[model samples]
Target: MSLDRRLATPALTTLLVVLIGLVTGCARIPTDGAVRDGTTELEQASEIGFIPAGPTPGASPDAIVQGFLTNAQAGPTSAASFAAAQEYLTPAAWRAWDRYVRVLVLDGDPQLVPEDLEEGATSTTVTGSAVVVATVDERGVYTEETDPSTVPVTFALTKRADGEWRISQLENGLMITTGFFSQAFHLTRLYFPTPDLAWWVPDVRWFPRQTWRTDATSEILAGPPEWLADSTTTVIPEGTSLAIDAVTVTDDGTIDVSLTSTITQATADQRALAVAQLEATLVEGEGRDVELSDGTSPLPVPDNAVISTPQTRGDALAVSDGALYRVVGQSLVDLEDAPSLDGLDPTALATGPGDRPIVVRDGSDRILRLSGTGVPDVVMTGRDLVPPSVDRFESVWSARGNTLLVGLASGGVQTLDVDWLDTRTVRSVRVSPEGARVAIVSSGPSGRLVHVAGIQRDADSVPTGLSTPVQVGASVDQVDVAVWQEDTVLALIGAEQDGDRAVFVAGVGGQAGTGGLARVLTGVTEPTWVTASVGSGAMLVLDGDDTLHARQTSSLWPPVAEGVDLVAYPG
Candidate 1:
């Protein structure tokens, strides 16, 4: 449906007026709240059977309460933790409690101090102050509320018939101290296919952290989330679902999944595609083999399947000096043959079909572009013009204050007809891989916060406007760069509360993986800039020392290249 070429104008006077006026509005150096508590480290859980048991049966009241809060709050997430938490509560209390009511996170464990609940009775309250960074609603909606009001979490006790003290009543919902979320819930993803079928798309989902090979597989079988409804496709047959609730991982780390008998009715190609989906989702299943439990068909992943993931080494491109280069490991291979970038000095770049999308500085300081096709003519002007992001529709989008300027491959310039433009300033913008969502750092009454908005494009892939904007979390104050590391996650490089530089990643419509903590990329601090591709394995960053580094999981960011000014990747 793309027409291949779009026309744009060379007007700078109008764009400059808006930029100068907004510069003096309010100068708050961008800073994310917290994440430095070692929450950024990635830890994978391989044993689902492990559970933190409570303190001994005859422990003191204060010890019993603290131990119960710690032992019972971990994963397999909220879904199954209730059954495990019953050990800490009386049988009657467990049955009447609602585990999903709300998650009350304390900065540290609840402090147990003697307080008078009744004139003649003794009570215990928080011994140490507690602060809640965020809250997850019943429907799993995550809200970043750094300073939510707190209520004392008190535990009541009683003596049973056997004369052993047990907790009779306690707060509902799962509870964990500030830094234990990663151990309680695995920040996992479900894979879906892009409309073009050339790339894979990952939709973020949180499962109770455990050896949950079945949790990841079942969610993938349920298909993509509603926000991604029309943007992505699933390979599983239309009605096919997981046939077994418990699939075991062999000692050798191979996963054999059993699908509903309905899979027998799928076509040869559908079956092959289904297996590809299985292979991608279960790659984190701590296993090597993803075979149909029915044992009728062979796993069919083509030699070159695009299994896009956040922690991956994806196709990365960069511009060194004035020439374009594809970052192949440590070497910068020049891609000078593309006619679109001839005779121009490129200052900034973004991901597109071939990494040809660039921002050229027309004057000594101006950076502008006319994007669409391999190369389109434009009158370049201004440095405030950040690199435009190319969405899946091939339509290019750039931010100027609150306005989103769109350049459709079909033709013409259009301002996104979105309503949020009047309220928030769009700092850095990155469209989701499926082109159905936009992750951006927006400023409103609450200052700058990271938000993900849904996009609505016309038939020709031209963006009309955005709808249903959702805040990712409240961990960061201002976002310098917001780019998609995978289809579901965005790698954020910004300042921390004290103005220290950090990198935080978040899912499109869920809690940050580290439970609202800013997951910092350890080795490199104050990176010059950060870049990531949609189907990438690693997040490439340029440190303040001019050293290029790549970070994936816990390993230190190994240097990739040197003398690199700006890094870029495919859209």
Candidate 2:
């Protein structure tokens, strides 16, 4: 079955079951169920349903507050669920509540502590507290709180005319447990186009299982996020909206998108780009297509229009003993027709589009471009320069301290302005595969920081500057290296709380705890260098002993090559 059908029927029913359990005052909701061993399916196939219950009469202030908190879990997804929860609150309090403001995901069940009430007092306050693991903004953007902290939740209740306790005052947003969050919300990717329209970049968003399609389509029309606004462009015309306010799938497996009259003003090229963006964002697996219409008339997309998918080169590049080689199986083979590095003492290497190699010389403070058969050309020279990275546009990117320098394809190098990295030393800089975003590792008063920012380019696709950066992997400390594992994910070498250095995976936008910020490998001794293949998620690391290791299916990092110094994949 298609993913949309699976989610629309089974997964959505599972969410409703969990929400109904919360409203019915179930003591514990089972997040996981037993599955048969050797099952090939990714998720279990089970359908469970329940009827949500409202508040019980004569309940105490503590029960009312607890019930209110539990029922609020459904507020972000279902209106009926929120209305059922409102029975525990007074009319004024319910009217004042705004569930769309934000959502706080707790580490576990919240603790309700009732304040000491005076004799015959008509009102009492119950204080709720829990360790927040993550938060969802009004835009449905999920930010994992790496440094989990305890936050206070307040609820004030009073006796109504029927002598039943009803909440009179409370915070605005919904508070849900992490278990509930995992079951109810899904991580979705919304695709945007690069300035040149050659590749698509993914923007991560979290939506409830029942409303993901509508939410994703609306967010696409609204444009990219704040930090990514300047780097990416959308062909969807301004002021365009969904005429029906919902995206529906037909029995023929086609996604029907009806737009407002504003889309009618867009040119044919604009419509084509819009269709490509929609297909990339909405179509998941094979055998699915997007059908667009401006309510009445069909908006056709050209059949021959193509937008290439971003991918790295097939083989990884490595430098050993002043020679460049390609990693093949368990051995390193000499690169064919490669430029000689007899006395240059190359230490780091990166390949750009068309297998163009750029190397950094040890102790020379210079980056050189190596052709098939010629002398190496000096591309960039600076003090304390990190390894150089070449983007798809063939522009070499390197950083000296806090300064960001880019070597243009036409000629001289340009110093791009990065106002956010003030006074901090840049450790590493890497451009995304599509050349739409750049990942930077830097250090300041708050230890090491990993940031991914959008790269702004002019009309001619020349490097201009960077947009505001969004920090990722905030929990990891003392980061030494950060590389792009995939379009929206990063591989980081950092430690947590002075622990041993380990390999961690973090999403581009602060998705730390929820299947992000995961520690993949540990027990490596004083690792110095790390690299990942963008085409395949393969990773390699160089330890202090000059031993090169590759990650296996398990946590083991077995030695792949001995006496290897540096390794990297094409950017």
Candidate 3:
């Protein structure tokens, strides 16, 4: 987003009028209905020194040129303004105004000049187009500078199909120099409909159907001619809005939020409302009042409620510490409860468990380790890296001293070991009871399915190859897969399209292997992990409800009240 002062404001004003002229004039000025003639209505207008009123043959070329000039200079605000400007030039001239003058000048003040020309030349060549050259001696009313710079400028005025003459080009470096100035017009109109729209999402980021507002201050600068703005208003779609209902802190200290209405599907109005609500919440903090358009009461948040960090014992979640620890008898401490994970360094750990959990303390440049006796114990105080800004591992398993694997966005796998980092591309990672493994549901560069290798482990060695990549037979509606047992279990990981949680299962890995992966349950909220009896066919399912459900592995999901914040099965 580049902002060049010369073209930022004045250029935008000019371009806006030109676009208005083209779109408005396109319909109001009728062309030869049948493509029966080689000369366009615009072409003929160029020859007569007039632009067409509508699209009459031999219309004045001057009229078309004047139309373009007037519209470019004066922002078109109505159909009449547009129609009046279409009379002076030829198709070529109108094309130039539409293509260059309006875009390069009105949209922005462009520094246009002849790049190349020949002597004894009645015309100059710019971008392979010929144009007449001259110097402007006139000056604008603004008297800031006593003298203005004089330079040669070129403009292409040509006859249209109908013999009408119009501007063909405006020679400016704007054709090449691009940034905030050149794209301002496009960006404006692109965001014009939802002038409040900040982004068109997915292409900008990866979420779909989401439009964001840059800020409450950015407004739609230009509107179509009066008639068009009114007529086309309905073209914009509606959006969704949300209202808060209740907020509660759970016994475990995690916040439990309940809403009377959240976005199920959004309309233009609903979406706008949602954006407004979100902005208010973000700026003023939660529970802020948001007025609705329908004259309903403003949404209010519950008092005495506060948001807190999530604490879970799910296999998908890892724990780290930021405290002092003795190498031989290390004890990990929760960074939140302790003074701070001040001096610990993850990379400098002399020795500890092969898969010791660690984390970089928030807002602090220290590392903490999670150690344990009966339960996991957090050991703080470790070595620090050289560069203070380098981000250390947020979550990773150390295979051996100085060797660790790091997961990253775009399904990339990074190995930081032996004092070097090597990146290997892969699909997303799926965390399971045993460890995190790469999912096989993704495609390789060759656009073919790849096979998944089974999990492997060696005595006294850190686990490796938790699951091999596999080439699935068909395109599956799944993002990740979870492993419970060697072959008797599997679960889905990550969020899905519908927003509702679900899990699929398969029995292909074990002896009776006929039940390949299949959908076993639906509407399972926040389903992230699973624990089942080896072959008993009974399983425990965890949900976003932060509760556990014990169900027959073969039956549809049903929650059992037996739940705990932390659960463990003895090896």
Rate residue 22 of model 3 by lDDT.
21
* TM-score per candidate: 0.72, 0.87, 0.25
lDDT of 2 by residue, 1-571 (tens): 1122222322133233532212222232223321001112234333223344567788878888776765667554555667778898999999999875787876556778898878777899999687786787777787767577899888899988788889999888877765456445556778888777788888887776567788889999999998889888888889999999789888988999999999988888888888878888787788888888989577877754477666676577777877778887667898888778776767667778657655555454888888666677788887778888888888888888899988877868989868999968899999988898899999887778988899988887888889898887776678888888876778888765547666777776544233232344554566788877775767788888888888754356778788887788777
Clashing pairs in 2: none
Off by over 4 Å in 2: 1-51, 74-80, 117-121, 512-525
**Pick by lDDT: which candidate is best?**
2
Give the range where candidate 1 is weakest over 10 consecutive residues by summed lDDT: 1-10
Query: Which candidate comes out best when scored by TM-score?
Result: 2
Q: Over the full model, what C-alpha lDDT does candidate 3 score relative to the true structure? A: 0.29
lDDT of 3 by residue, 425-524 (tens): 2232222222222223332334322223332333322333333232322212443434333222344443334544456553221111111212334435
Each candidate structure's count of clashing pairs: 18, 0, 94
What would you estimate as the lDDT of candidate 2? 0.74
Find the number of clashing residue pairs for candidate 3: 94
The CA lDDT of each predicted structure is: 0.59, 0.74, 0.29
Model 3, runs deviating above 4 Å: 1-451, 454-468, 472-475, 485-488, 494-500, 507-517, 522-526, 561-571
